[model samples]
Target: MSCPRTKPAWSSLLGNSRLTTIPIICFGHLSIMVQVGDEIPSISLCEENPSDYVDLKKELAEGNGLIIGVPAAFSPTCSDTHIPDYISSPSLSSAGKVFVVSVNDAFVMRAWGKSLDKEKKSGIRFLGDATGAFTKALSVDFDATSALGNVRSKRYAIKTVNGKVSGVFIEPDNTGLDVSAAQKILA
Candidate 1:
């Protein structure tokens, strides 16, 4: 026969008024965004066409890389300028493996990637954070329900070295292209 159920140690500790109260740290309420020196999270991002998944943490650990976070794929600024900058920039060849991450699905990201790099000449990899898990792990995902009817990643770029962020540029309003631009980051 199974013994009677008992409250866990945590519950007993919580009930002990005599024990000093310790404040718990809550990341859910944190408003801070990802910053330099933060380690990249081991989240999987997807790619379409042939269909594959990449673990960002593993990528980071393998070598230096750049992660560009955008609000959405095919949006005016993202389509017209942001991604194109990296595609056309000479520095891109030397910027290490580059990833363009968005909250869209794999199909949309694949199409957008093809549109941006029809010849696949550029090495930029378009990644779909379909569930926003990777984006949230970076602390760069934001609620864009009003504008996009879903949560999305803020505009940002992170330069990573062996899984650790060496540099970061995050757009203040999540809509601007000033800070996270390739020119600015390369400069």
Candidate 2:
């Protein structure tokens, strides 16, 4: 026979009353913590290209690029808020291009893209953060050691020119304000 689920002990402690939990702790919603006007570090990202990956030094040459860093692909926050804003925003117009990055594998990133909008391909390129070597170099990696495995990147976006960051938008809270949704920057 299948085992039945047990009631959570915390709720039972409420004496059958549905007591609303109060905020006892103020969580740390750190900003990009990494600043803007800082020189962007060059890092390799995997493209759909046959060579499996592209060189960051070569790809970031001659134009501006919007590099978006997400904590993980397919997570509720990232899916519902982050990447969708970038794909839907008209203001993300730049002389260069836009790329969405996460520490997931290439396949997961691709699947996330298709779920976001398969019809609108090419507007946003999904890059794989398979090893997170690149994310670490940018100083955005946070020790999500509790739930999310090893170190992970915090959410943020940067506009880079010739590999130097000119503009940045990092979420104060991990729930809202995706970088591509920055109308002023886009304008």
Candidate 3:
């Protein structure tokens, strides 16, 4: 029998690492084959911006898209290193549509988006995969019950062009890494 008060996936990822204070946390190794030629997921979700809800097909159709998956928002790696790098790095411009995806509510995503220095948000958009629908499609969703209370997605990044994944960077240890850092991808 499953416990009614089970652990949550969010709590763990947000709490697992040691990046609580830093503004730009960067992870190192990733091992996943979300390589080029793979079609990105066709999913839709509400954006923090009331007027900017995202319809994956429409958004991905526009141009190259950067889809970032995180265990949870505000987690050490996510807040301190992972996201800050992408939002601030000038090289990130190459990926046309930059989005941060987490299994959090719209409000949380919005707050997190706003927390970043205003300048960092210039080229990035924070999106809520609140329902985990998109995460399930990607096959990265995991049972993060110890802290997050339910299933959640892993920390990862993928680049898509014309709706097909061209590059995928997934943390091998499933912790923190710069799988899709602008400096590495841009060069």
Candidate 4:
């Protein structure tokens, strides 16, 4: 006599191949990095305009915002292509407050900002997360010792509504633009 087969139990898909019955949040086929409904952590960032520090939580609370994370400021991909998308997009004005964040100092970010938005027409803010505190808080910071050296933020974008995360598009490889492009976010 054999027992009847029970329904297959789903489990949390942690990074490891090993699976367990433990339940956890997930995004598509991978384990969760950051997901909808999570509150954006309170952190301070250096802003280029007026050259002062601003609290992310306070800024995000005023309205919807887009946070764009790049590995570094002035990197080839970031400078030439990635950020320029957001800078040149006509839809950016309607995307609420947009911020380009990098793990570099304010001086570097300010210079890069000038290079991209020469007249500051886009209204997109370039912010410096020099200490990596804000990036780490989002759980998107990665170690790129081979190419970039030290810990750096994964290329990603987050859409926040009143300080709570409503949507997140994170690159699987930490450097690709497949999911985190401005066009995709505006869509």
Candidate 5:
């Protein structure tokens, strides 16, 4: 695929001193965001530690599962609202193997997970996309450099059955606390 050279947009909000929007420059391929019926990507994500890797392709292929993608590990909305809903949702038990992924290192993810579920009662596993390969493969990544320091996954809830996407709930605002909320998906 040939990438088109598009001009960057300058914003008056910054006195037009710098480009506000960065054009998408594809090197050899264009990534289309994941859609329904898409199979889970065979990417290895970090689990608790850098050396501990977990691949969901095989696990998700066998049963129902939920993958919750967040922008950061301990951000305000993510820590206070988003993940707590899933952790406390009664219906989440039936959702099968629930995994929460973030574009953070394994240590941060592990610490955040423990802080939320001290007793590990949630049964939700926290995984790290340290290099964001998993998020990029899913095409759910967004440039969050302004707020979160780097590219991050948009808030999303993906339901999987037999390793194929059954439902996808992505927040329209990228980092909003709606649509992908547990109340909506778990119901």
Candidate 6:
């Protein structure tokens, strides 16, 4: 019996070759992970509340800044070590407009920020990527369902100069506490 389905363009190009692998070009949304020299995505993130949104692209457009991506808010490693390290770092003041981004709601991010920097001495802003839009825009969102119950960003640190990435530090294991640490980035 002859198959009724028409062959795809790629299959027609291959012409019945017994190739084990075929390359296909898809005209769909392609996500490219953040890298050095890449411009910050024009995605809005929430601050203290859901209604208050901040455009990161605009915020970092004219300054030296640091964007820190943590898997979740209030998590053990993130709360205890990661963020605190940046808060206490002497280099922090020079880092300029430091932002801590988490795949959480604005209320949760605000509370977590308060819990960590009680006096707000760190001057580090906590941003909420509620729908993971910002994280996905940077192509850093990971399937953290087994751990945090949903998609979360990989542990990463990006140094930006005028909204363009100058440095990218991402933990290879997705949620480790090493390469993206404040001490290393600040130094």
Candidate 2 lDDT by residue in tens digits, 25-67: 4355443444666666566777653247855556666588888
lDDT of 3: 0.75
Candidate 4 lDDT (Cα, 0 to 1): 0.83
Clashes of each: 0, 0, 17, 0, 0, 0
Q: Which of candidates 1 and 6 reaches a greater lDDT?
A: 6
Q: Count clashing pairs, candidate 2.
A: 0
**Preferred candidate (TM-score higher): 3 or 5:** 5
**Model 5 over residues 80-149: C-alpha lDDT tens digits?**
9999999999999989999999999999999999999999899999999999999999989988999888
Could you give candidate 6's per-residue lDDT for residues 104-134 as a string of tens digits? 9999999999999988998999999999999
Listed in order, each prediction's TM-score against the native is 0.82, 0.70, 0.74, 0.79, 0.85, 0.84
Encode model 1's per-residue lDDT on 23-140: one tens digit a residue. 4443445545677888888888898842588887888785779999999999999999999998989888667889999999899999999999998899888999989988887778
lDDT, residue 143, model 6 = 89
Clashing residue pairs in candidate 5 (N, C-alpha, C atoms within 3 angstroms): none
List residue ranges in candidate 4 displaced over 4 A.
Answer: 1-32, 49-51
Using lDDT as the yardstick, the better of models 3 and 6 is: 6
Q: TM-score of model 6 relative to the true fold?
A: 0.84
Among all windows of ten consecutive residues in candidate 2, which has the lowest summed lDDT? 20-29
Regions of model 5 farther than 4 Å from truth:
1-29
What TM-score would candidate 5 get against the native?
A: 0.85
Candidate 3 residue 118 C-alpha distance from true site, Å? 3.3
RMSD (Å) per prediction: 9.8, 9.7, 13.1, 9.3, 5.7, 7.1
Angstrom error of the Cα, residue 168, model 5: value is: 0.6
**Clash pairs of candidate 1?**
none
Error of 5 at 174 (Å): 0.5
The CA lDDT of each predicted structure is 0.86, 0.69, 0.75, 0.83, 0.91, 0.91
